[model samples]
Target chain A: MSGVKQRVPQIILTVVALLLIASAFVARPEGGSAPLGPRLLAIADQEFATWFSILAVFAFLMGGLNLVATHLAKIRERGPDRFYSLVTLVSFLVVLVIGTAKLGGPPGLQGDVTAPGSWLTAVFDAVLSPLHATLYSLLAFYIASASYRAFRARSLESSLLLGSALVVLLGRIPAGRHLTAWIPEPLAFLRVEELSLWILRVPNTAGQRALMIGIALGVIALAVRMIAGVEKDPRSGGDGS
Target chain B: MSGWFAPGTWNIALVGAFVCAVIVFSVIRSRRGAMVAVRPLPPLLALDRAVADAVAGGRPVYFVAGSQDLDNMQTVAALAVLRPLARKVAEAGGRLFVPTNRSLVMDNAREICRRAYLDAGRADLWRDDWVAYISDDHLGFVARVDGLIARERPGLCVLMGFFASESLLLAEGGHHVGAVQIAGTASAVQLPFLVASCDHVLLGEELFAAGASLEGDAARLGSLRGQDLCKLAAAACLVAGSLVATLADVTGAQPWLFLRDAFLNVFRAG
Candidate 1:
């Protein structure tokens, strides 16, 4: 009985999905004059997608509670770390209360607490966005360090990589173009700017396309497996045996 | 409902049908007990060792399932790997800590871990704390993992799936704590961060392969056979198309140019 229960949903859902996909090819009936199958599939697709969006909203609220539970645990631990936890929770509550209660603005227009001039918006604009920007700025230093480690010249490949890196780096900035301005027009292709742009348009694009293709194939394989019921029976958590 | 069929997606539908045909063929052959060969991924090899090491030393294994909610495909596919890993850890009497930022993901992880432990006949080892929610904020999750890494000093760190800017920071933190790190992702932009910082890195498609192979089901693994065959066909097309275009460029031949366009038309969107 349990096995049947698991397999039934999987089979039905797969059929419904395949139907929806097939519906994309069937031309819509004009003025509801024909083709019941295509119309039903279209309805199923829209309804299912709307249902998914509703579920996502609920999940977002659940995620908020999850964050609260985690930080509350840290506060209960009673240590120096508790200070950070308290800060996070207090900040969360202040925003929640102010936003929910609509303390600043007129009532019933309470949603999107990050609206203009609200306290939540003020905190976001003055404090949180700046902090996010600060964190993003740290990535520049991290990128430099990572580039240093990656571009070190220790082997034949590394030497070529380092050379390529130097060219690309010099080509991107105006100072680099100025440094190579003395190169004759006859050998203009050797200029850092042209070389860098060529590298970006040619080799870099080629590599990116290859990666994108591979990812596409991987996704196709996964999607096919899902449609074929090959991965697992989601309910039983096994092959529908 | 915007009527029945949507235009401008026929190319995708055609490609999907081709892939589905290939998959159906492969699945049938696989079910008949034909061999579906898969190359061993080096990073996944390291994964086994790291898990074993964690078991031996009685240290915990930490898995970062990225910052995405449960809706993300990477997170969902990653559970294929997490389930088996949970089973292994349970059998070995060691612990696995999975920090999820989404409540739904946490719930899914708990169910997967529970089922895995039950399959391994170690259901007693399963605990809700094994997989729990942290915070949804990207940096918030990274900070929590950093503290966990610094304190627990896990024997193994598996960071995989969809990762964004926090990829390098969290991987570097794991490295700072001196754990054997194995990172995998299909995020093209974040691949280098994992490669530069981790002990072993699974680039792009290799992550999917790792998850499938760990599942140990031939029918599931057979999907890779179809993917490989499609890739081979794609490679042939690329080589042929490029040669035709080159010929057109060199000889300035109208016929060659016409052939090149014909080849390109197969892939071009309408």
Candidate 2:
């Protein structure tokens, strides 16, 4: 009985996966076409999509609850980081209350939580947006530091990387264009801008495309393993069958 | 026929079916004791060293499953890699912390770590607080992680999954704290940032392959082999297509053009 019970979920998963794959391949019936199979598959696909959206809402709720619980525990422990936890809880509750009550909007639950003058909108625009922007701006400094370390011509690969990066960076500016303006028309292809464009369009694109293809193949293999029930469920934690 | 297979998608269906068949066959062969070997990934080795260092240093190991939800395949791959790492941390008697942006992922991550500890006979060391649900806001999550890294000063930081701009922040934060960092993602745009900042980085499909290699399971290894075969086939097609297209462009031959289009049509959507 226990074995049977365990197999049931696997069976359901396999069936659902197969059905979804079939649905994706089979076209829906057109006007006045009475194919029952394709129509049924299409409906199943739509239903699954709907179910997923519903599940996503619940997942967010669960996440919100977990966040609350975690912060509460931290506050109760009076740890060194309890102050940060308290700030997070306060921020979360303020946003949640303002958004739920539709405060400072048209004054009803039906009003938009993000209406221009609403408290939620103000919080988002005045606080959250600036914070997001500030954090994003930090990437510039991080990039400079990372580039300093990576662009050092220590080896053959690093030399190539440094050379190409130099060309690409310099090629984008007016100085690079002026530097190469003395070259004859016949040798224009060797100009910095042209070289940079060729590098980006040819080798860079080719490498990116090859990587994408490899990633796609990997995804397919993983999906096949999952649909075939060969993958060990992390929840089960079994030495894979 | 149109109703049987969607327009512009039949080619995809054919490819999908072929790939699925190949993977399934390989998996069956593996289950039947066929030998499969995976090339060593340095990032995974670095991950092992990181765990050992954390254990020796008595500092926690932090695993960041980038700011992506469970629906993303990259996130799934991240979780796959996490299972083995968690098990290692558990057996080594080292602390492991996972901060996630998605609740669903947080739940799954907690389960994986719990099972790992249980399997290692260290369930008592597993704490619910180990996997915390961070904020859903992108930068907010990064800020919290930055703070965690600064405060805790973890010895090892393993980042795997889909990341956007925050990839740099997380990696740089780890770098500043002198943590041994191993990062992996299939996102091509983010790969350069990680490679530059991380101690070791897994490029593209290597992230997926890392998970399979770490599992050391025949079935997953077989699937990895099958994926390689598909990549070879794809490369052949690309070379052939490029050659035919180039010849058509140079020669202005009708037959060459026809052949090129015919070949390209097999892969193109309607």
Over 4 Å off, model 2: A1-5, A32-34, B249-258
Runs in model 1 lying further than 4 Å from the true structure: A23-39, A70-86, A109-112, A233-241, B1-8, B249-258
What is the alpha-carbon RMSD of candidate 2 to the true structure? 1.7
lDDT, residue A198, model 2: 89
- Please report how far candidate 2 places residue B253 from its true position, in Å: 5.3
Residue A177 alpha-carbon offset, candidate 2, angstroms: 1.1
Model 2 lDDT tens row, A1-241: 7567658888988888899989888877776584788888888999988998999899999999999999999999999999999999999998999888888898775677788999998999999999999889999999999999999999999999999999998789989888898999999999999999989999999999989998898888877877777777766674642
DockQ of each: 0.44, 0.77
True-vs-predicted CA distance for residue A82, candidate 1, Å: 5.0
lDDT of 1 at A221: 81
Which lDDT tens digits does candidate 2 get at residues B41-141? 89997787889988899889999987898778889889989899999999999999999999899999999999988888999999989999998888999
